[model samples]
Target chain A: MIRTAFFVSGRTAITAEILGHSLITQFDDVNFRRIVLPFIDTEEKALQAVAQIKAQAEADQCRPVVFSTFISENLRKLFVMDEALTLDFFETFIGPLEKELERQSSHTAGKVHAISNFEEYKHRIDAVNFATTHDDGGMAKNLQDADVILVGVSRSGKTPTCLYLALQYGIKAANYPFTPEDFADHRLPKPLHPFRNKLIGITIEPQRLSQIRQSRKPDSQYAQLSTCEQEVKLAESLMQHERIPFLNTTRLSIEELSTTIMLKAGLKRRCY
Target chain B: MIRTAFFVSGRTAITAEILGHSLITQFDDVNFRRIVLPFIDTEEKALQAVAQIKAQAEADQCRPVVFSTFISENLRKLFVMDEALTLDFFETFIGPLEKELERQSSHTAGKVHAISNFEEYKHRIDAVNFATTHDDGGMAKNLQDADVILVGVSRSGKTPTCLYLALQYGIKAANYPFTPEDFADHRLPKPLHPFRNKLIGITIEPQRLSQIRQSRKPDSQYAQLSTCEQEVKLAESLMQHERIPFLNTTRLSIEELSTTIMLKAGLKRRCY
Candidate 1:
């Protein structure tokens, strides 16, 4: 049975969605139509959300599930409807936290994604700029400053992973593609020699790489299965020869790749 | 008092960090030294995390806070420590969800950010590439295909916002900077005329714009406050004349800005 799951929050609803997704993803057998109701900070907005939830429930002929992170007690109470199953994150944790910490909960909202610290916020933006400048071996001179430089064949999930690292963790991630020239050379690129410690190789299955490249450039020589196999084999061998750690991105998402790279490089996140 | 807060998970621990940040941000008075422990799928890893938490608690002279999203019942038990306040996300929500949904949760891990749907995953990657290629008026001919086009003064947060929209929501976000030439014309850029509905103006406080420009090109005319003010005024006027909705990005993070823009543009997310 398909049910509607509403993720309600006082602010961006990002946290509510994250928490809700974690719970809902467990029930993979059931399909859920996810709806996000952000900035529902008032009783009126809460009432509106309630009505929407009821309407969806009526349409689906079942109770809609609501996962909320509303800190306002009044706003939270408004969502406690008989028409839906309400799971309030703050209500479940805040009171316990208050007692444990020996302090009353402030019960404020919208601080999760706010620019609470300017220095850190700017640091993240700078990281993103750095990644952009250094993408696809651009600005190789700046490789010395990169927290981690990803080496891989083109379309082996380098660009997105670098961007993810920069955007998510404030880590200056530079990625260099393993070109045909580099493959023929049979050695690490000269520029990458000095910063061996900061190098992480990304590898993908030849079949998968061919499929991805085919999507980008259909019927091209680069997208041929044979070409993909040779390039991936060469890239993996070079990484292994250099003793550089690598990850296969065939099954992993960008988030997983970035997180794994951060851990492997022992790189500290500049911002949370 | 300062305390160490460990965000532990069986997978990337990203959700744990998000949920923990949501809860901990409520207590502005307390300082938290946050640490993320991802990929703790094994009992040994959980035990190590428990030890780390204990060490942090002893060092801080108080119990550390542990926010975990481990789906494994065995791994979950290992985190239950006398030296830390353990808050398990799955433990708190799964049983209640089962009761509410009238279905059993699969009790799986690492599916939250997985590429479950290949088509959606490719769509997200394509969006990112589109945002990259069409960034800063690179491909004016491709603007017609864009889901939303962001027009703003340079350094008013056009690049990061576009990138965030692409990476997070899989929205084809192309940005065009209102340059001196456009300001001289006292009108919207000619390229943006065809797709007015796809336009969203990004504006920042003159002071903030100046600061951002100064960081990029210190001591340049573009970094001057007066130049920033003039550019911003002209951009705002053009946007108002063209009836384009705008957002002030001075206080918003990329996530907040992108979310708000998606809402304003009525752009449905292509990925969850």
Candidate 2:
């Protein structure tokens, strides 16, 4: 069994934890013991953490792996000096950035060149705000302001895609629910009727949707396999009649969904 | 006026654009003369992309930066063979991840971990569902289910934090507006009456809030200096009365806010 320790120092411990989790998920078929050294803010604290890990490793008769994301250089250097610690996975933001600057020395125009696409960045922020405010069940009058409307059944990953588009691309995305009532009526949601051209549908494989719903409402009628299939089929049929462009959200992550939506909606990519 | 080019390839073109925008943000100076490359799948297409980037860089008399996320290994090797074009900056996911994994081998357990607190991850997913059902208006009934409830004036970065927690930690976070009505009454939002303990308030420097708000609603009363000051003072005072824990979101990124909220709310860190 290998022993590992994560040394985190930042204004927030949660960031460290999230990063730590992401890192650990990569390892497979290993008996791993883990420890978190949170709030190691000072160089002294970092050195102490190294010493502790070294002593623990010696006691256990195994070298301990130490991963750190501390911003302090002094702390980082102290850990680097420790021979017992076999690894230091520190995420340093400035080093690569500085190298890029030095390489582009002759072409350095100023910060304005760096932010040539500021307007697009601003628009992405606006899009996220628009999507957040114009969510389903709101007043009908607000729907007119939507640039693109997303309609989907529950557990179809609509909300996340909308937020991503808004936060990242600055598109005005509004999502409306395709409920039993809409399916039964063989039409889009009432609020989405006026903006049919801008309407985009999201669908997922019924089994996947069922599994997602099952986690939240196990053994419920709404989460039944048959019910999920029915809703998906009905929603797809309705979308076909309405001539709405749709994307499958089953295999795609939120990032992919947002990108597809932006491309299909003819919205200019803001960030690039 | 040095000319530069960026060769980008990914699963989607928009992702390449967003990444390009992020890279531009990192550089303080430099003029990117043009960006060349296509968004394509398959190794053959990727090699074609490499050839195009090499030719462009040579013509421009500059070593272009090639930025890619997911491309074939054959294409990666092809780019490496060319010394004139600096293909090192290609932002492929695997290279850095592999480096991190190898670096991690000598450390704790030699596993690259996903950084996240797991409980917070579960809570974030719940928060997405909760946020969908309850917006600023439905804060009361949904307050009970929230792992951490955030309340603040507009542009306090409440929604982003809530969404980040939901997406990253799968926490069910709900947010309520500390609107003028709530402030005048010197109480939490009507919906938050029953679950005061779960409530957390977000505060920001009035000036910063005003600046952010001004971007959305320039010259509006809501974005005015005095108006922001009044709203902040009232919101903080009301939070104090309700005995809700609060954090200042002024300088904290979305990552920081979500993490801090997780810690303060006593949610177990899930990923680390």
Candidate 3:
């Protein structure tokens, strides 16, 4: 049995959980207890965490494991005074990082992702706006401004990838769903032709594509496995003909797809 | 005159950039050189990083500020061999964390945000599918399954927030655009009544809303400031009347807004 605790100087729930979830997968049959200590900017609050850990240790007959992202050394030291074990993410990493970056860590809190830089936040909003407007490539007539234009058959992971790129990287990504007409003619969509250099084609296995479309339009010709197979085949040929870099998203997550697209297209991210 | 550098064991670009950007804003005169050393799962790669850091140090005529997130102590020691200053995110923090969790650090790579667990990844995709199918509310018409329903005027940050909740947390979020007809009556549309318990209202400042709408529909009545102001006011009143938890997205970013909604509504995230 294991008792895992999370403590941070700021709202470290997101960061801690991200690491914990991965760790949990590796070790099964472990009892997990998350002791979240947020806003521990002072030594007093830190000692309070010590008390909680001590209490848990007494009850469990063993020391609890603590994962922390606290920015303050003094506050972290208070936790170290307790019987519980610790994983001090900030203190452990900051010194070497100071050397690597040629500067000292600011030891700042709440800057992990949100409310840190207004400029970066605004850039994300603008990217989302751009993505929403240019979605399906029909709403926005201006394709030249896009950082990357994602082309794919309907429901081939274009829209979600575009949204991920916009929300995560703040890149001006626009997605155009290739209709059957475009597939038959063996050409890129009309508006997308000018932005061929920025095009990234996304396709899925025909079986998976059919599964997705079947949920949307059951018993329809559009949802037929044959139609899905045909569209995917044509889209891949179109991408090859145009020399556009494409990825099959059947097994890849959106993060993988977007990162690969970012590398392939060399699209600079505006924000994190 | 400051030449800052970054190094990490895992893919630390996202984490490094988040902290680095905040540090950059604090010190505007510094130069940054990000040297990402991903896949440092072995001792060989870690030594290669030492070589790269040494070259940069000699060329720049100054010791570089090194920020590292390497999870291995043996590999991290290789960097200490180099002339660059160091801040070790992983090594500095892992011992205490091991104590906290009562277990040793796993030192896993390629799992920070992606490819950690396929089940979690699948949940996120399913949430995205649920969100896209349920987007605009009218499209899905199945409100009972939604983890949360977002009601707001057009371009009030509803769609993007829904996507964010879906992609990031794997929460089944759906959004509805409150139309002019709903605004005229100063009430939520009839369709949203059944899912009142799952509703989270999002509104933006009229000025910001107008700005966003203007980009989508230039010089239209929908994009007018007056229209924005009126809709926002009516939406707020309707939220008040219905006792829905609402947020003003003008100052808050999408992440912040969605997080607050998740907390207020007590929605358990399906995935990380």
Q: Give each prediction's DockQ, rounded to 2 decimals.
A: 0.79, 0.26, 0.31
Ten consecutive residues with minimal summed lDDT in candidate 2 chain A? A105-114
**Candidate 1 lDDT by residue in tens digits, A1-272:** 79899999888888888889878989977898999888887788888989999999889989999999888888889888888999999999887788778898677778888777878888888998998899999999879899999999999989988888988899999999999899787899898889999999999999999999999999999999999999999999999999999999999998889889988999888875
Highest-scoring model, lDDT: 1
Model 2: what TM-score?
0.73
Clashing pairs in 1: none
lDDT of model 2, residue A258: 68
TM-score of chain A of each: 0.98, 0.67, 0.83
Please report the candidate that would top TM-score against the real structure.
1
Let me know the DockQ for model 1: 0.79
Q: What is the iRMSD in Å for candidate 3?
A: 4.1
Model 3 docking category:
acceptable
Cα error, residue B92 of model 1, in Å, equals: 0.7
